[model samples]
Target: MAANKLYIGRKVRDLRQANRATQAQFAERLGISVSYLNQIENNQRPVSAGVLVALAEKFRIDLAELSGGEGDRLVSALSETLTDTLFDGYTPSLQELKLVTQNAPGFAHALIAAHRAYRHNSEQLASINDTLGRSLAAAETTPYEEVRDFFHFVDNYIGDLDMLAEALAAEIGIGDADPGPVLSGYLERHYGVRVARATQNDDLVRAYDPEARLLTLNPYLPAPTRHFQIALQIAQLHAEAVVDSVAAGAGFRTTEAYEICRIGLHNYFAGALLLPYRRFMAAAREVRHDLDLLAARFGASLEQVCHRLSTLQRPGQKGVPIFFARIDRAGNITKRHSATRLQFARFGAACPLWNAHQAFESPGRITRQLAETPDGARYLCLSMQVSRGGRGFRQPQQHYALALGCEVSYAENFIYADDMDLTNASAYDPIGISCRICERTQCASRAVPPLKGRLVIEHNMRRTIPYSIRPAGDAPQS
Candidate 1:
């Protein structure tokens, strides 16, 4: 085969396995000998044009699937992983990466998994110190982080669970209005579980007595919170099978992780039940994804509506691909989910230049920012403050900034991006994953030096940043 000839043995093997056909069966269907098929599948020979046509005709496989999407994604992910400081900047050539992706995809995936595990351990150690890592290298990942990684890999979308929640919503006659009343009625009539409000002494946001068939919610809790708690209870009581089904293959590190994942799934179902996908997507389009309007229409809080918007990635009926995160006053990410290519840092705070931190200062108002990542991806980010706990003077309000953002490609669909100059590079703030990992030295907000570069401290001279950093191999500055 010529170098330019197409070799999609991996894709061919995938299609054959998908159809559950042996090499002989597949070869016969394609009107080819088993030996020739074997050669093609093993990349010993290029797939002929005739074989491509035969494949489309027999298996109805889209030729586009064979055009290296998964390979490209694998290459990109592998490249990103290898560029981490842990790999010492030893990035493989693009051609080498392509070979790994196409010829040894399973091994490539294993490498990615090991890299993720390594990154997880590094993050855990960063929180404490390297001393803990030296002795207890085996037990590096925590339960919360393990579950978070599972969701992160899945793009925070559970297809079957989403569908199940949508179906339950429809079956219960819940629509683009308050789901609380309907959910309460359904619980009482079907499960004989009566919903009630708890007094101050209850000191719980939500409590359910299964034996008594009672669900007690904090009376002072926000309406959306109350409804969410009710729906979560419904998920735990009725949708355990679906939750367990999703949890079974999640590869959780501990029982706590498994249970926490179930809660997360139930919370997902609750959100789906409250803001049903079809109606929410339609309303979001009508309003151009205005968070306040969507909140009012769906009877959800700004945070709830924003969080729900990120999970609208159904197979055919997808909405704007977005990332949603919640951060506290101290910059701790309380909740994070993203359907976009941009991923949150597994440990440490987000980039200081990101607008999410400013949301705390401007409470009850939406802060809009045009931000670009180190990878050159731009996003239209919206952030607003969310407050919890207001029962008494002693109960101080817990403030969190909820950030909702989408890639700049979808900026036209967002009301927040209306007046921003999306084309101008200067309009966007340069943000990165974290200070320790970020390579941008020009940032005045950088608290520490980057992990990849060698720091050069000048005793007599000081730039805007404390120290100058250059790539490891670069000659010393004159």
Candidate 2:
């Protein structure tokens, strides 16, 4: 099959129009001829790698957008354009289609659409045995919901594991050692299981053979990943009671989510046991939540430090009720949770104007903002970009923005608040959460109407913002 080609002409056009740039103006900014820019926008010429990189750098747009792999609208359009015979007889429900496009966008563009043409005329053959009208099991299940709920229980925090791993390593005099050897030694000493590599009949990176009391680990995983997996296994064994107690009565459609949740909870327990909540919280307060210092002291990753910061909200010893979230360049919410009353959109994307996205451009630099809505609710946000899981010369690193924020009134408690520039009444950046969950009436960043509002577009008497809306269930214009 031919490699899937991305035609981002429409996106280029949309962005150009949104920026109010004429073709000649855009061409000059791109350091290209107007005719060349026109050809690229019209799909007469493909965007070169050099030009694509330049556009990403100059316009502050994500490379994923140029490659056409990130946004829902673009993915959905690509899926529709690639539909073949297999999709002809039965039209898919919008939700199922969306799931495919969002989860396996590259696969859909490369395989599903190409296979459709070949399978167009083919049909499922009738079965020989007559089993007509037999009732079948329900086709839908909510495994994702179960997983989501499980993560929600922990508020998506996993700081405990990092502390435990560090302490354990220290005790064994392997605190600064390679993870694979350290984990292998720890597992052998604690579980009486030997770490071995199995080449046949196994599809997992790590698995425990209960019959032999042996733990099999894939040799290909990096040291950090290996250590994490082993620690997670130990956590499951030692923290079963803690996890089951928390997961009790949680509804699950499929056991898969529950199983994954169990593993994740075990990892969290491992970190907690290592750091111990009381000691870690004390250290965190003492350090003013300096992430690098915390990471070094606790032997945790920067991501782990930030994640742990959100879980300091235990009753009777409650810390700040800050909201935590991580986002990629295209504004995909990789993780999110809140201890406050602030709610996020369960579906759809977050607001693009948030400081989290801006952190990607100025990596390693902290960006602080105080945002308010038209309704007078205010938040103080602190965001920074961090990278994960890449090493050596050529490996690709995953970059994400980590943000912590709280209600405006509580902002003074944080270290960043000490800086007058960040706390200045007039200097805060104006931003919002995604439109669906935000109730701000005058936001210029709104991409869609708030969930139930009817758009009121009056061209002649426009507001400062491009869109206006009436409350849901109100009368429509004639």
What is candidate 2's CA lDDT for residue 222?
55
Error of 1 at 296 (Å): 1.0
Instruction: List per-prediction Cα lDDT, in the order shown.
Output: 0.81, 0.62
Show model 1 residue runs off by greater than 4 Å.
1-86, 92-139
Clashing pairs in 1: none
Best by lDDT: 1
lDDT of 1: 0.81
Q: What is the lDDT of residue 170 in candidate 1?
A: 84
The TM-scores, one per candidate, come to 0.82, 0.59
Tens-digit lDDT track of model 2 for 22-132? 999988888999998887776667778778888888788866535632233323333433332234334455445544554455665455334433333122113314434
Candidate 2, residue 61: how far the Cα is off, in Å:
50
Write the residue-wise lDDT of candidate 1 on 323-355 in tens digits. Answer: 899999999998887766566765567898999
